[model samples]
Target: MDGLTGLLDGARARGAFLLRSVLDPPFALRIEDRAPLTVVALVRGAAWVVPDDGEPARLDLGDVAVLRGPDAYTVADDPATPPQVVIHPGQRCTTLRGEPLTSTPGLGVRTWGTGPDGSTVMLTGTYQLPGELSRRLLTALPALLVVTGDDWRSPLVPLLAEEMSRDAPGQEAVLDRLLDLLLIAALRTWFARPGTAPAWYAAAGDPVVGPALRLLQEDPARPWTVAALAAEVGVSRAALARRFTELVGEPPMTFLTGWRLTLAADLLREPDATVGAVARRVGYGSPFALSAAFRRVHGVSPSEHRIGAATGD
Candidate 1:
């Protein structure tokens, strides 16, 4: 798979938070949900996304805006609009004073709003858990990335709006998959714009480094070396190293080590995963070897990392 696809493969949105927000002209919502990622699409009318640290961006119909979070942001009819509702972690809606507003009557299936016939309408999907998105992919995004409707064409906005109101069996799973697709589409479109692709993404199109990267991602558990990777990709070790470093901004082996450790860190978060098993799964020869490397690179032992993740320390 290509690098973008490989990174996106990790996005398994389990019961992802989704909603169709309908609001009147004078409305604002302060979102402090701290979700890892969120996609906001304007279905009707227009809206403004005011990120905590970036300039406010206006979204017209069919425009999609991606917001990276853990930091709070505001969505409103205008950048100056005061927030009337606050969405907390777990998507709990409340008034400004922490009074629960979740029971405030819903507009429709998976739909909520200030009024029934509000002027602005938006569809939102949030990946609540950090694990739902790979760190590799998240790191490549800005705090706020917008794909204007004029830049690309996609039918996902309408499709998602239709599916949001469904209540059939396995519907949650379907929405999750749909959200994933929408995210991928938006990102692919964003990255395809001139001068917007990340280094690794650009490197994926290089003849010499592309195949080598695929091999590494497809079989990260294999015992791989620069020379071996070069041979497998039909190039000399020195040549491959130069091309890979130039294009991807890292040596092949260095990149492979980071990829393995990233996989190990994610695997280590599972309750049933033991250090030895994770080590073996990520190409280390033994638990001790993996532990040393992990500590050196991440400044934590496998056990310590697991404990911290568990306790949210």
Candidate 2:
């Protein structure tokens, strides 16, 4: 897999919270949901995304904005509008005073707003939990990033909006895949913009290092060494090492180890996963060996990680 695809593989949305929001003017939401990520698409009227630590971004019709969260932000018709509602964890809605907000009426399936004929329309998809590989992508983003219609144009928003209100079997799975596609497309466009691509992303286009990265990520269980990787990539060992380090900011083996451990860590989160199984899957010879390396990098053993993941601690 390519760098972008490999990074996004772990971030696929499954039963994510999605909704079509219709509203009139003077609408604002103080979002402290602590979700890892959220995608907002302005379908009709305009809106503003105000981040706590970054400059406010204006979203015109057909624009999409991605908010990397765990930090607070506000979405409103205007930047000056005060938030009338606060979105809490678990997708709870309440007034600024913490009283449950019952005034917002349901417009239709998977939609809520003041009324169906509200002037502004927006579609929102929130990833409530962090993905296994999302850490790499999230670290490369700012608090908020906006992609305008003029920069990148696609029918994803309209398509997703139509799918939002549908009631049928397996609809949630469909929406999940759609949301993943929209997010992938948006990030792909965003990363293509000047000065926005991360180091690993940018390095993926290099002829020498790109294939090497794919090899490491595609088969983490393979026992790989510098000479083996270099021979496979048709480069001398020293040349491959120098170029990989210069471009990827790490040696081949170091990158391999990190990739292996990342997979192991994610696998251990599964309730049925055992350390021995995870170790074998990620290329370690024994659970003890994997534990030592996992602790050094993650600061926790596999079992400890599973517990913490389950408890959200």
Candidate 3:
């Protein structure tokens, strides 16, 4: 798989929180939910996404906004609207004074809002915990990215809205996949726009470094060297190294090591996986070697990381 695809593939949603929010004008929501990532598609009417640290951006009908979070932001009918609702972590809803609002009658399946016929309708999908691999993709994004409706065309948003209210068996799994598709489609369109794509994303089109990056990502378990990678991609070691570093902003081997260790960190989270097993899987020769490298990169041993993860520290 290519680098961009691999990065997004890791973001497969598990029990993602999806909702259709119906609201009237003169409404605002202070979203301090601190979710790792959120995608908001305006199904009707318009709204403004005001990030705490960035300029406010408006979302028109059919426009989708992707927000990178754990930070607070506000969504409202207008930039000047005061927040009436505060959405807390875990998708809990409350008034500005903290009275519970979840008990407010639902408009329909997987839908909630101030009223059934509110003027503005929006679909929200939150990736509550984006795993280690997806974090790589998320890190490259700005705090708020909006794919204008006029610039990109897709049927996924309407399909997602249609499927969201269903209650059939395996419905959640279906929604998860749909959410992934929507995100990928939106990102592909966003990255294709001039001057918006990140460096790594743009480098994926390079003849030499592009293939080299794919090789590294495709089989990170392979014990790869600069010369070996160059040979595989049909370039001289010096040429590949210079070009890869220039485009990717890191030496090839350094990037590979980081990739391997990242894979190792994720593998270590598996309940049945042993440190030695994860080491071999990520290209390390032994647990001790992996431990040293992990410590150097993450400032924690694999065991400590696992313990902290388990304890939620």
| lDDT head-to-head 2 vs 3, winner | 3
TM-score of each: 0.89, 0.89, 0.90
Which candidate's lDDT is highest? Answer: 1
Q: Predictions ranked by lDDT, top down? A: 1, 3, 2
Off by over 4 Å in 3: 269-271, 303-313
List the lowest-lDDT window of 10 residues for candidate 1.
304-313
Candidate 2 is scored at a TM of 0.89
Select the stronger candidate by TM-score from 1 and 3. 3
Q: Stretches of candidate 2 above 4 Å error? A: 131-136, 269-272, 307-313
For this target, which candidate reaches the highest TM-score against the unseen true structure?
Answer: 3
Summarize candidate 2's per-residue lDDT along 105-168 as a digit string, tens digits.
5587888787988888999999877642355566678778899999888999999999998999
For candidate 1, report its TM-score: 0.89
Question: Each candidate's root-mean-square deviation in Å?
Answer: 2.4, 2.4, 2.4
- What stretches of model 1 exceed 4 Å from their correct place? 103-106, 269-273, 299-313
